[model samples]
Target: MRILLTNDDGIQAHGLRVLYKAFREAGHDVHCVAPVTEQSAVGHAVTIALPLRVKEFKENGFRGHGVYGTPVDCVKLALSALLYEKPDLVVSGINAGANVGVDLLYSGTVSAATEGAFMGFPALAISYDDFNHEGLTGEHGSYVANLVERLPLDNLPHKCVLNLNFPNRPVAECRELRICRHTSAMWEDWYDQRHDPRGRPYYWLTGVIPPEKVSADTDRALLTAGHVTLTPLRFDFTDYDLIQSLGGSLE
Candidate 1:
């Protein structure tokens, strides 16, 4: 299969490199186009005014393009300009950290794959829950790559993408994958006020992420229980039910 790889973390990230190697070793033709710098929290924004720059880089037997833009821009350019033919699938990440719940609204990794999904292709966004590289290795990368290969892309909903989050456990301990729903969770905090060297006020946003109340089949609950969570995400944010109810009230 021909796969287009991308990520929110820049092209040089270890996570991207490891996954690229695993995909190539699996005999699939893989092409990568990622941001030149980390584009985390950028969501699904595409460049509108300024021109995007794409530069080529060769490393670890994988040739890739680094775009001086957001993760969404990288995927857009790859499909429209870079690749001569349409890829069978678009896979974003092996990202450095998990993208779950309300956090998906700010995740460039998920946004990159969503861009592909909007263009009529099966797209996936895979992330490792932990930010630390304690036990991360080629074997772990291979395991995730295999899981991506086994996904039922042929039966997925139109213009929808799979948002996958793996546990921080060792690859050998990765037991089962669960089809789950995104948790209705959110971060709660305010900025900390501090003084600069010149006695000016500055604020640093820092706080703990409080856990949400778990409902049945939530991605957060499944991930906390050590299962790999696969949530089918759609680009449409419309509340159709609300619209219908409002129409009756307005009339």
Candidate 2:
């Protein structure tokens, strides 16, 4: 398959390099177009007003393009102008952190894959379940490469994007991949007030997931259990039932 790889973590992230190597070794043609800087939580944003810049992104012997904008912008440019030939699949990450539960609402990694799907391509948003990488390497990259190789891509729903999360455990220890649901959970949010050297106050947003609310079938729950989770996602955000419920009630 000809694959177009991208990430919110920028074109130079280790995860992208690992995925690039694994895919090449698996005999697939791959190209990358990603943010020049990390755009992690900037979900689905597009650069419309400001003129976007594009430059060559190269590191550790790999070559790709870097866009001075959001992850969605990179994929949009790739499908619309960057790649010489359209990719058969768009793989948006091996992101630094998992995009599960309500976190999906603010994930640029997921949004990149979503943009690909919206452009009518089969896509995947992949990530590691652990945020602390203390011991990750390219050695385990094949686990993801093989998953893509074995997936029934032709069987997926039209314009569907899959969100895949690998557990923090060793790749060899990774258990069966399971189809799962995003957790119906919310972050316990708080802002940390801090002072600068000049005595100015600044607040940094911080939050945590309430573990007790995590259910058995959610991607977060499965990832916590050492299973790789695959959640099929769609770009459509319509709440049809609610739309019907309020259709005739409003004046």
Candidate 3:
């Protein structure tokens, strides 16, 4: 497959580079156009107000274009103008953190794949549950690349994107892949108020979705149980049932 790889973790991220090597070794023509700096949690933001810059990054036989914008911008720019040909598959991530539960609402990793799906292409978003990248190896990337190769992606519905998350455990220790649903669990977050050297208060956000609230067989729940989770997501925001009821009452 001709693959377009991108990430929210920037072009130089270890996860992205690992995937790049694995994909190249797998014999897929891979082109990466990613953010020059980390754009995690930026969601589907675009760079409309300012001109976006594209820079080429070549180091140690790895080549990719880095965009000074959001993950969505990289996909949009690459598909619309940067690449000479449309890719057969648009793959985002191998992201450092899992984008499950409410995290999907603010995840640049998932949003990158979402943008590709919005543009009528098959897309997949890959993420790991761990934020720490220590003790990682190319095997993780190989595991992801192998899964991508084996998935029946061509059979996916139009405008659908798959969100895949792996548990923090090593690939060998992780359980079998489970097709799952995204959890509707909410984040129980709190902002920490701290004083700067000047005595000004600044707040830092930190939170977690209570494990008790996560439903069984959902992405978050399964991933926590050391299982790889795959959730097929669609972008339609229409609440048809509500529309019908509201139309009848208002009319």
* Alpha-carbon local distance difference test for all models: 0.86, 0.87, 0.91
- Superpose all Cα atoms of candidate 1 onto the true structure and report the RMSD in Å to 1 decimal: 1.7
| Model 2, span 158-179: residue lDDT tens | 8898999888878878888999
Q: What ranges in model 2 sit over 4 Å off?
A: none
Instruction: Return whichever of 2 and 3 wins on lDDT.
Output: 3
Q: Candidate 3 lDDT, tens digit per residue, 120-152?
A: 899999899988765356888888778887888
Off by over 4 Å in 1: none
Instruction: Give all TM-scores, in the order shown.
Output: 0.93, 0.95, 0.97
Clashing pairs in 1: none
2 versus 3: better TM-score goes to? 3
Clashes of each: 0, 0, 0
**Best-fitting candidate, measured by lDDT?**
3
In lDDT terms, how accurate is model 2? 0.87
Better of 1 and 3 by lDDT: 3
